[model samples]
Target chain A: MFFFALIVKPLVLFILGLNKRGQNNLPVKGPAIIAANHNSHLDTLVLMSLFPIAKIHKIRPVAAADYFLRSGFMKWFSTYCIDIIPLDRKNRVNKKALFAECHKALDNGDILILFPEGSRGTPEQMSQLKKGVFHLVKDRDDTQVTPVVLRGLGRALPKGTALFVPFNCDVVIGQPVPAQEKADDFIKLLASRYDNLFQYCVTHQEPEQ
Target chain B: MFNIPQNSLYTMLLVLLFLCIGTITRLVLKAKFPQKDYTELRQRIQSWWWMVAILFFALVFSKTTAIILFALISYLALKEFLSIVPSRPADRRVIFWAYIIIPFQYYWAATSWYGMFIIFIPVYVFLFLPMRMVLVGETKGFIRSAGVLHWAIMLTVFCLSHIAYLLVLEDKNPQAGPIGLVLFLVIMTQLNDVSQYIWGKLFGKHKIIPKVSPNKTWEGFLGGLVTITILSGLVAPILTPLGFAYGLLAGLIISSSGFIGDVVISSVKRDLQIKDSGSLIPGHGGILDRMDSMMFTAPLFFHFLYYVKY
Candidate 1:
């Protein structure tokens, strides 16, 4: 928390600026899900920094265990520093156990940040979302799943790139999609919500020659 | 307490006076016309207070601080401009180079390297960026991308950096230092903007450029010109080394160029099909929206002063 407030927040705010809209749509109290498109590693940090520092303890990002836990230092950093709930992406045998931790976090009223696109894709392009977010929210009708679309972070600090060019990124938080009975229906609803929210980003103008 | 310059101190006081006057006028107007919403006016005034305070401290602190402040302004304006304009995916690396140019550009101003500072963007950056873009092997939309990227750098970084370069001027005027020169230019430019808006609202019948900016009128333009010219004639001698005649010329240059800058950005916004560039400032729109006139006025004012005094 000290590290985040001192370093991460300022770096995110000052260097890579976030022009956020619908910040009020983020539930004040949680038992909530913040599902956004994955573009860059900065997406997690940008979203976490959006909340007040006091609520930083209650917010947890669900990340891939295979990637985040590959190195000993990374495991420690992801677990302690970022406070991620590491999900086992390799083995489906422990799927129930993996979801148990997520259920437990929500049961404790912690906000879980999930990237439904599975992993970082092409910069500023949205890939087909996996059904993982749907499975998490399917039974938990009480939990509010907020769809957030992050633009320009991918361009600023996209995957396979260490260099961070300064760019104004947009964080558009939409009204929480109500839990549907079917997984396909839920994913469709979430996808449509993201489509609607993506429109609110900085309107792309044809470069005048 | 900080060994502030006498001229800078007076300018700060004058700015505070204007802020007070604006507040009192708004209060009186709210009282008289209770039905009308003064929310936008109130927001504008509040934002002005913040902008003025930040700018005042930056200019008065030190030359380095002032240069860095303007550099940040250039970064923000460029960010807003880039976010609005569409860029090719291949040009993303080229965009990184664009951001990198800002620091080097300001470094020239900080060191007062006039020879390199003048040609860095137009000559070096203009040639280098396209070559770098060509290396990406994506020729589709190549010309358009190069044009957009270069223009963004020129407008945001190259033009606005002139304000910072003002601080490093080798002038012999004891009464008007480099800081005073900056204060003079900024105050005159902003005052020109305010007076034009007020005049336009009061009696803006003849549309000057209705297609680009519907709100701009000839009456407003002339009213603002006369007001700024007279004010400059009075104020420039105190803040700058210019006499009354040169001051009037400075006023004429700022007012007309400031209008061109405003409409130029307006035309860009119109072409982009957006109302505001970004919602960085409450009433002013974006940093680009606020500094659009400065983009034009800064370079022109610097050259004018350079030719005359420097």
Candidate 2:
């Protein structure tokens, strides 16, 4: 089960180096947020595999409901094995039920993986973070927020492309930023934190050059 | 005749001593330095204990079995090294040479070709590796390409083969053989590492070139050297052909060389701006982290055994 994928995933990516960093920041306990910058769909697998899923609670990734949730098998795999929480990007205001589902998951002390950018953007700069993360954490002050930056996954498998590039993926997990005042400012800080985290992972990365 | 069973027991005792010291140091650090998550430290101690257990079992096992296991270890360590450091597509042929040539260097020792094992990687492979790369003729990343491949060969293949070469040392008694010698070298080298780390943590004040390895200290070097020196003298008669005095001196040499090795690899990671080389080993960072002490210690200890025993 868990051991199968753990062995297979790394075995498959053994040649690529799968260079990961900052896994120490993952809390050994519950109600943790993996606030990451999304680049490509493979970003899901990158973070999921990088973190010790065996030790930590199953991660509920907030993937795009409109895109990934469309297919029956994709939804099931993303929800169960990959454990993604797909959210609709088109109807943000109308997506109250999705927000409730995320809140309930976090309330039960389960791990929530959020792509704060709401949608995948160009590889360079992160976009404005949607309010879901802030709204979810505004009440539960004890939850830990981790800014994760997935730098290479996009290039490895970019948007609207089926090709899986063999480039190395770096997963940088920044130090936990606990819940605080100024919701908008905190979101900005989280985004900036991801930016800094990404820089550190890339700069500290073993350059094949 | 030097008693094989006694030497085996002695090795086990030393391994236990090191394990206790490492574990205690970690516990003390957790109590004293409450700020840091000493989990990594604890994990390191645990891994070392497992490593010691493995080594102990390997030594007690038949000579052929021990050599075979060591060969497997060298393969794994080298594989981990090659995975992290990128090689050019053109250098793929050299890599073939690297994987194929390296195991034979150890195989030479296993088959008791002492002379050939000693200089196989340095003299022959060193010469041939460059020529093979030259023939492939991917001149685009000439410096980067050749440099990394060369480094991979030197660190992974050349340095590591010395572990296997330890099998060739003959003693007055068959029981007091190369197995004890190989086990001794590894034990002493790793002990030096643990001693230095503990000493550094306890009394380390001077940075000892802070930028290179921030955690290392002059205090640790002195403490580790003195401790390993004494242990070396005590264990020398049982393990090596060297007298107690030379064994002590070898311990001192190996410890200091091991420090330099750690620093040299530290500098490599520093140049790359990486913290740990890789996370293949849970507690230990990467192959480089595990092999840092081995790089310098292997060559130094190998030659020492070569001159005295051969």
Model 1, position B267: C-alpha lDDT score: 92
TM-score of each: 0.94, 0.66
User: What range of 10 consecutive residues in model 2 chain B has the weakest lDDT sum?
Assistant: B83-92
Clashing pairs in 2: A65-A87
lDDT of 2 at B169: 58
**CAPRI verdict (incorrect, acceptable, medium, high) for model 2:** incorrect
* TM-score of candidate 1 to 2 decimals: 0.94
True lDDT of residue B152, candidate 2: 67
Cα lDDT for residue B52, candidate 1: 92
Q: Which regions of candidate 1 are displaced past 4 Å? A: A92-95, A203-209, B24-39
Candidate 1 B-chain TM-score = 0.96
**Going through the candidates in order, what fraction of the true interface contacts does each contain?**
0.56, 0.04
lDDT of 1 by residue, B28-56 (tens): 99999999999999999999999998998
lDDT of each: 0.88, 0.72
